[model samples]
Target: MGIDDRAPGRPRSREADAAILDAALELLIERGAVATSIEQVARRAGVTRATVYRRFPDKAQLLIATIEAAYGDPPPTQEIRDVEHLLTGWASILASPRLRRLLRRLYGAIEDFPEIARAYQRMLGQQRDQARRNVFERARDRGQFPPDTDSDVLLDLLTGAGWQHLAIQPDNCTVEDTERFLRAVLHQAGYRPDGYRQQLVPQGQQPARPGDKE
Candidate 1:
C-alpha cells in the first residue's frame, strides 16, 4: 500500500495488512524487539499508527503476528509416513537460514519483551512438538522405532540436535553437515531410517542391531 492509504477501522486492505506485517518483521529481525514499535512499523509501512494499533491492538500482538506471517505454519506431522519423511522435513527446517535468524531474533528479543517472546515461543513450540509427536507415534506403530521406545525422550534428542545446530552452533556446522549429523543422531536414537528392515522389537526391550546378510 502506498502513502495515504485508507484510515484505520475502515475496510482494511490486504495490501496494507501485508505491508504492515512485512515492515514489522523486517524491523524485528534488523533492530530486534525493543527497537521495534508500532510507531516505527507504521512509519516503515507507510501506514498510520492508528492503522497498526487498530490491526494489532498492542505491540506484543503485532510483533507475534509479524513472526507468524514470516514463518507461516509448521508442517503437519500426520502426513509423515516414515522416519525418512520426519527427518528430511526437520532437516529442511533446521538448515533454513530464515529460521536460524528467526530463532536468534526471538531469543535476542526475549530480554526486552519477555511476555511477547514467551508467548510466541510457546505458540511456535506447541505446534512443533505436536508435529514431532505425530511422527514419533507413526514411526512407533510401523516398527520404525522399538516397541519400547520412549517417544518424548527420542523427541528431546532430535529437538536438541536441531536446536544446537540452529541456535548454538550455526557456525560450527554447515547446513549439509548439520543435516547429516541429525540423521546420524536419529539413527543413534533408535530411528531405523526408511528402506531398513522394520525388525519389530519386543515391548520393554531395546531394538535389535543389524545382522550380517547371508
Candidate 2:
C-alpha cells in the first residue's frame, strides 16, 4: 500500500507486503540487524526482489519500516479516573509473558545497535514514556499520589520493577507475585484500590470482584 502506483498488469500485492514485513521482524528478533538482508527477507517472504524494491528502496528503509511496525505507536493516553483503573491497566502488562520477552529483547540489545535503537525510541519509546507520565499526573491530581510526588521518578520506579522482572526476576517470580509487588509499590505511593473503587460505586452497589477488599 505504501508503494508507488503500479503498472497496468501488476496491482500491488498486500499479501507480499505483509509477508516481507513479518519475515523482516522475525529476522530482526532472531538474528539482529547485521544478519537481516534484503535477499534473505525476500526469500523468506516468498517474494521477488522487485516486490521488495517496489515497497522499500533499500535494506535500511525496509528494516526501519519493520521495526516501526513491530513497535507500534502507543495508545492515546486516557484520564486515570481512579487507582483501580490504573492498577488493572498495569496488571495486564504484568500478566503477559510474550510482552515481557519482546521488551527484554529490545532493552537488552539497544545499546550495541545504535541505528535500530534510535529508530525504536523515535517510534515507540517516547510515546510509552509519555503514557506513563500521563497516568502518574492524573493519579496525582485525583489524590492517589501525594501532591509532592514526582511522576517522573515514580514512572522510573515502576519501569524499573518491570525491567527487573524481565532481566533478573523472570525465573524467580510468578505473575501473581509480580502483581503483589507492584501493588505494594502503589501502596507506598498512596494508591489504595479499595479506597478509590468503593467510593466510585453507589451505596447499594457492591464491588464486582473480591479484589475490592483491602
Candidate 3:
C-alpha cells in the first residue's frame, strides 16, 4: 500500500526500479504531472500498483525519483573550462524534448500541488549547489577565477537567475541567448572570458568591419 509496507526479507529488483522510473518519466512527459496517475505509471511499467507503492510512498516521491533519473547523477568530474562546453551542456539538456515537456508539466503542476512543487524546488537547489561547487573548483584550478571568489554568489548570478527565468518567463529563451547573457554577466564579474565572443555572435550575422571598434 505504501513504501513502508513492503514485504520483509526480499530485495527489490533494480531492473524493476529502473523500469518504473522510466515509465514515470514517459507518463510525466505525455500527460503532465496533473494527469499522470500512479496507476497509469504501474500499467505502463507492466507492474502492479502495489509494486509502485512499494518503491514510492506517494506521487510526489515517484515524481522526484523520475526527475532525478531524467537528469542523471551530477557530473563526477570538475566543471567545464571553456564557455563553449558549458553552454553546450546546457543546450543539450534544454533541447531534450522529454525534459522540455517535463518542465512544462512541472510548471503547471506547481499550482495545484504545492508540496510537490516545494520538493522539486529543494531538489533544484541541491543540483545548483553541486554544480556551483564543481564549476568553482575547476575555475580555481585553471586560474580563471580568484581563489577567494564566492562560488555561491557567482552561481546565483550566472545560473540561478537563468533557471528562475526559464521557469517563470512566458517566452522561451534560446539556449544561445541565455548563454550569451550569462557570459556577459560573468565576464563583467571578473570571470575569465573564453570563447564568449564567438558564442555571442548570432548565426549569419556579419562581423563588424576592421574600423568598427568604435
Winning candidate number (lDDT): 1
Worst 10 residues of 1 by lDDT: 205-214
**After TM-score superposition, what is the CA distance of residue 29 in candidate 2 from its true location, in Å?**
2.7
Q: What is the TM-score of each candidate against the true structure?
A: 0.77, 0.67, 0.61
Tens-place lDDT per residue, model 2, 4-54, is 235667777787878999888887667667667888898888877778887
lDDT against the true structure, each candidate: 0.73, 0.67, 0.69
| Candidate 2: residue 205 lDDT (0-100) | 74
Q: Which residue pairs show collisions in model 3?
A: none
**What are the RMSDs of all candidates, in order?**
4.0, 7.6, 8.5
lDDT score, residue 76, model 3? 34
- Using lDDT, rank the candidates from best to worst: 1, 3, 2
Question: Considering TM-score, where higher is better, how would the candidates rank from best to worst?
Answer: 1, 2, 3
Which of candidates 1 and 2 is the stronger one according to lDDT? 1
Per-residue CA lDDT of model 3 for 1-214, tens digit only, reads 2332346777887767988999999988888887889999988887789889888989998998898789885543435655456656665565455676677777778786677778866756566557656776577556566556777787667665556645664445576765666666667666663311223466887543222373
Which candidate number has the best TM-score? Answer: 1
Model 2 has an lDDT value of: 0.67
Tens-place lDDT digits, model 1, residues 61-165: 888888767767434324566567677766766667766777677767768679886776575656667767877877878767667788789888887777677
TM-score of model 1 (CA atoms): 0.77
